[model samples]
Target: MTTQSIKVTIKRGPDGQGAFDVPAHDNQTVLDVVSWVQQNADPTLSYRFACRVGMCGSCAMMVNGVPRWTCRTHISKVIKDGAVTIAPLRNLPVIKDLVVDMDPFFDKWVEAEGVHHGSLTRHDPIAPVDETSATRVEANAGIECINCSVCYAACDTVAGNPDYLGPAALQRAWTLLNDAKDEGRGAILDAVSGSGGCHNCHSIGSCTTYCPNDLDPMSAIAGLKRETTKSFFRRGR
Candidate 1:
């Protein structure tokens, strides 16, 4: 019996770059291919993955020019001409083969004021949250983000503007803004309304298109825009 094979090309930075013909199997995922390469072909191949079930976005990579979670991306879905190309996520500094520096990606989150600032301390009585409220509904829309950076990698605005806060950061800001208990509304708005803020977004929807969790960071940015505009008008009055 003869085993079928697929061509796999990996972008291995300056020193190493090449393709390998690996045995293909049914229901094989891109992660599986990469793991095989590291285990059989090259032990030096470096990549990051925590949860292979798609919960952790650490396995995200550029597959065929699109950012996708390698663990969830099956070879059958993305294979073209019996071949696949894997590279580090774009708009980030490549650390090595299939790995990119995530510091800058996370730094933007802090710059966007994505962290929650509460008015109450831990000793204070916990306030009951109205889950059905309008603000809660909007907040819930983007709260599922795992900071996978998939949307960040797909965003063209981030590619062009290095200072621009990427989709995840801006979306997180919007999420915090809608939280009833959050007291950082003023700071978040001020942060996102700056030159490299939400306005820098091209509204291309690539963040939404590539988000593995199906969260819409594009819409969240639009929400920030609307809120910022309203904030601008209210201050004038």
Candidate 2:
């Protein structure tokens, strides 16, 4: 065991004075140490967690200046010399301690027009799709996202522009576009092509790297851009 105590600084409140420190433990993750502080060190500690397995995007937070899912982040790997800092994810208003309101994060989904507008009702016959089709394969991995905004927090574009749809929404739009049967493709493209749309992304690939699911939203955004460009030329943009 490393004989070093990882220093963990956490945002305690809304006040500018909101700050607290905790020592690290050997083989401990940021989440584990935070849980330790909340359980034994500080009773007033507040944070969010579900499925401690990293499958749920609920436990994302700023660790050592980067947004990460605490459950999967090991303190030994992140904290330097037994030093660490924790806080709610950035680009979102803090509720308290370590929890940030997710309404805005999810609100972007609707804002992106992520919902499919296909006329095919649930009662309609299920259209046959080639499982091995390129588009289906493209849609496969992206559909696995659990709605965690780690990518959102890690995105500098979202930080720069609040109205930007962020990675997840564009990824969802890409998924719908790949559906081939969805009727909302044009609207999705148009919505994302405008201000705060898919065009806003600077393509830094932060969303690709931080994604827990290994999905590349940059690629999805690229796909949207290509589709938008094709339509743009067809319509004289």
Candidate 3:
């Protein structure tokens, strides 16, 4: 009996594709296929992975032209005609084969003021907050993001407007805005109110669609739109 194999085509960073014949197994993931090629075919094959169980979100890549967590993507689900194409995430600089530069993705976070700006000091007593409050509920909606950049790669807005704060950053800003202890809500609103902010989103919902964590970045951006608009008019008042 002939051993079953899967055709793997990996797009190297600016160098073009590297084709390989990888042996297939039951319940094999895309990452497993890549790992086989790297271990058996080409030792130079490059990629990223951590906590392969899906919590880290570092194993994201373009599998068959769709951004996905390779560890979570089973070959059975994605492979077509015994072939799979793998490439680096889009809208970001490719560092090597399947490894894209994440600096631009995270930089948008800084630009969006995604970090928490809390007024509470270590010396200050612990403040009680209602976990079931609407604000907390809203904050929790977008807080599970692991910075995978999958949504960033899938985002059409980021592709059109390079300066547009991508879904993750805007989602982060939304979460921070709803945080009751945050002191930088005003600054965050100002940051996201710019031309490159939440308004740039077309509500295409690609971010919500491709998120490995199943997050709702589109809704978060919508929240930012409403909040920023309110802030704009409040300032006018």
| TM-score of each prediction | 0.97, 0.92, 0.97
Q: What is the lDDT of residue 195 in candidate 3?
A: 85
Candidates in order have lDDT scores of 0.93, 0.83, 0.93
Give the least accurate 10-residue stretch of model 1, judged by summed lDDT: 1-10
lDDT tens per residue, model 2, 112-229: 7788677778899988888799998887758998888889988999999999999999899889888867778778888888898988899999999989888999999999889988
Write one digit per residue (lDDT tens) for candidate 3, span 74-182: 9999888888899999999999888999999999999999998977889999988889999999999888999999999999889989999999999999999998988
Q: Residue pairs in steric clash, candidate 1? A: none
True-vs-predicted CA distance for residue 106, candidate 1, Å: 0.6
167: Cα error in model 3, Å: 0.3
Q: Give the per-residue lDDT of model 1 (tens digit) for 1-237.
A: 124898999987555777999899988999999999999999989999998999979999999899999999999999988888999899999888888999999999999998989879889999889999999999999999998999999999989999999999999999999999899999999999999999998899999999999999999999999999999999999
Output the TM-score of candidate 2: 0.92
Query: Which sections of candidate 1 miss by over 4 Å?
Result: 1-3
Candidate 3 C-alpha error for residue 134, in Å: 0.5
